[model samples]
Target chain A: MSQHAQDYTPSEREEHQAMHLLPVRRADLPFLISLALIAAVYIVLIVGILAAKVFYVELPLIGEVFTNPGYRYAVMLSLISCSVTTILSLWIAVPAAYLMTRVRFPGKRLVDAILDIPIVLPPLVIGLGLLMLFQTPPGAWIQQYVRFTYAIPGLILAQFMVSCAFATRSMMASFAEINPRQEQVAVTLGCSRSQAFWMVVLPEARRGMIPAATIAWARAMGEFGPVLVFAGTTRMRTEVMPTTIFLELQVGNLGMATAVAVVMLITSLVILVLMRVAGRGMRMM
Target chain B: MIEFQDVSIQLGSFALEHVQLHIPTGTYAVLMGRTGCGKTTLLEAACGLRPLQAGRIALMGRDVTDLPPGQRGVGLVPQDGALFTTMTVADHLGFALRVRKRPRKEILARVEELADWLGIRYLLPRKPHGLSGGERQRVAIGRAMAGHPDVLCLDEPFSALDEETHADMIALLRRVQRDTSVTVLHITHNRNEAQALGDHVHVLKDGVLERQDPKLWKK
Candidate 1:
């Protein structure tokens, strides 16, 4: 007879203690070791790159990069732009994802495909497209009032375009994982649809928003080809931290470039860690 | 009274055709069916969670077929309680009153009353994660009753409990239905449970509902 877990009696359960205590099989070694070796290569590569950057640049160059007005301004601008982009992305992503997950509407697949265009399009292509769009009549009309081509606003727009797709994807998965029955129960208990969303669904999705924001912030920080193509590398004008690396390299300042790169790397690492810790705390609660 | 008059529902490939059921006021109704037999789907239709393809549902003699789940004046305890993972037990108990913007004192009084009645007063400050399965169901029942709803729909409320816990829950549900005098439609697959608690027992088969005598279930 086939034995199920719940069907085990007291004597059978005692016998099953041996099943739980069984030693690791020798046949699993090759599979386990191969997977570990492949994983170790990626970890070592990341550690090696960080070590090379630290060693290639002098410590004082890192300090000088921080103290330099142009570089400092670039850092501030990058931070501000990334924060703003993350906020705006979340503002659109949360509602869009909730609707996409819960509500059935006409042209949903078409809308979904259009939203994924940014994620699939090459970074340079997005910048080129944005530039071309400005040249169009309607785009030109909007540009007349607000300059987006080769401006700071272009930097945010570029980041938001790419990052929002990722945020929306994360949020959609988050909402999908939550059981809709809770919201149904809430509605049956006198809450309207909007009230159930705000009270029940949103609270349960708090953990998901963390990863979405972190991914968006990281994407914004690392963005290069789009910002470089759309927004020019004008020092103290539209230059962000990523562009700082390009600009420093252009002037034969390799150490300064590596230092700026290191700063970006460390900033991203710190924020990722902080966000993960916050997510963990939320899960515990 | 709660009534499902010639209801027909289609969900993807699964369909419940011409389902009919009635439970008089202040009675405990038990719905029994095998797994995947559309018992929950039928319950959802009555609660306005699912739209019927044909026919209508009436609650307390009111035609509530087109009414939204909230406006239908029903409280649902979905499978495994479906308790809000983020809120405290007290928050769950006070949720309906709070949403209606009832007085803070009134909400607190109702919360206390339900908590004490459900014997979950000590669990008031804790969220659902730490709650035992039986305790969670009690809290769910308390929350459902907090709104003083005209009807309570319980979906497989005791399927997860041990024998002892299940017996306790049966007694508790009986007491709750008797004291509150609210109409209840409880779904379960266990025949013994139907015999233990039901005033009117039903069985679903081949997408049709049939009223059955619980005492004659053994035959």
Candidate 2:
């Protein structure tokens, strides 16, 4: 090799020159443009839908629909049922979460995976499955004992199944993030396992639990498919807000349906705000 | 006295096997080892946090091998202090007292005394996260000591502090041990810490305990 050429390799010299150049490559422009285009399209579609719903729809009858005694009853029933569902789900989920995080036993992975199945299953499928199961002989026997079919209990059960999965998943994550060493330390400081968890772990996990509860509650509030299939849309009986909205939409009562949707949206927003506040509190702790 | 008789535990790849030792009453013994040498595991096993696959653990002449940690009469201060993040310093100090059903005034009085002793009287109202690492460790030690345990297990308790703070804490721990007659099983990776704080030192390697020469002090 010539002395001059030996002083520096062609690759090294080229690398040196490239290092001085701005790192942005020609290939990035297309990606940036595509991302911008997708964002714009998403915003435009959302705004267009909102504009149509606000201006073109005959929504004035929504105010009268809210005043209707039957609608009010449906709303109240939905709130009460969903609240019960949320509480029931949390009651089961907190202990299940504790067991899942703190203890190691056989079939724990299987139990965890099974708990997560409802999240992946479609709501309509879950409803149909529940309906079929409850309608069968073994389920009929259960109904005789517990009254599972065409009742408020059936609606709560369906909502519980769907919402519990979400609550459990959130709570499990919360528990996992907590160092088990904290509880161990507690035990060393003269706390029983349950005492350690209740005093230390639960308080730390409370922030995550709050959001999880809110999500479950909102999910129960908007629950329609399972409630319709299992509970039967009986007006002033098993009828809930989502069921009422479904019935109204079926009968071409667009104004009432939108009003119910608006109520649900507002409720969800309030719950989300509460969850944020709880999350902030947790962070502070 | 806290005694371990050939205790062995296998947690995944790490194993603490055939570990036998004794910490006599009111002795300041330090377990020195490198990282992953099972010092923490030994402390945990002694406290009944980890189930022993073999052998036994005894505290003050009673075989507490199968006993739960709460009944073992042992206090532990973990690395990073492990202060109850949800609790104030006073609350952490009062926790064991409350569990033992001690009177409210007694608990408060003891907590106040310990807080004053540790120079954490002003930190009584603050939670663990708000305090500095040294303050948290002090609170952890105070909380453990408040219960009047048979033995105090400190696992690398001074490793989180700066050099000056580390020295101060070692001196503080020594002073407390002298005044309280509490048996301490302090664990550390640093030989200097072992020398400074330990009356008897046990060097651990791969879960095996080996006593080092008392004269072989590092620095």
How much does each candidate deviate from the true structure in C-alpha RMSD?
Answer: 5.1, 9.6
Q: Report the C-alpha displacement of residue A209, candidate 2, in angstroms.
A: 1.9
Place model 1 in a CAPRI quality band: medium
Best by lDDT: 1
Model 2 residue B23 CA deviation (Å) reads 2.8
Best by DockQ: 1
lDDT of 1 by residue, A1-285 (tens): 112232222345688797788566789889878999999999999899989987887788778767989889999999999999999999999999999999889999999998899899999999888888889999999988999978989889988889999999999988887778888998998888999999999998887899999999999988888898888789898899989898888899888899898888889989999998888787777
Q: All candidates' TM-scores? A: 0.93, 0.88
> For model 2, what is the alpha-carbon lDDT of residue A275?
74
Best by TM-score: 1
Q: How well is candidate 1 docked (DockQ)?
A: 0.49
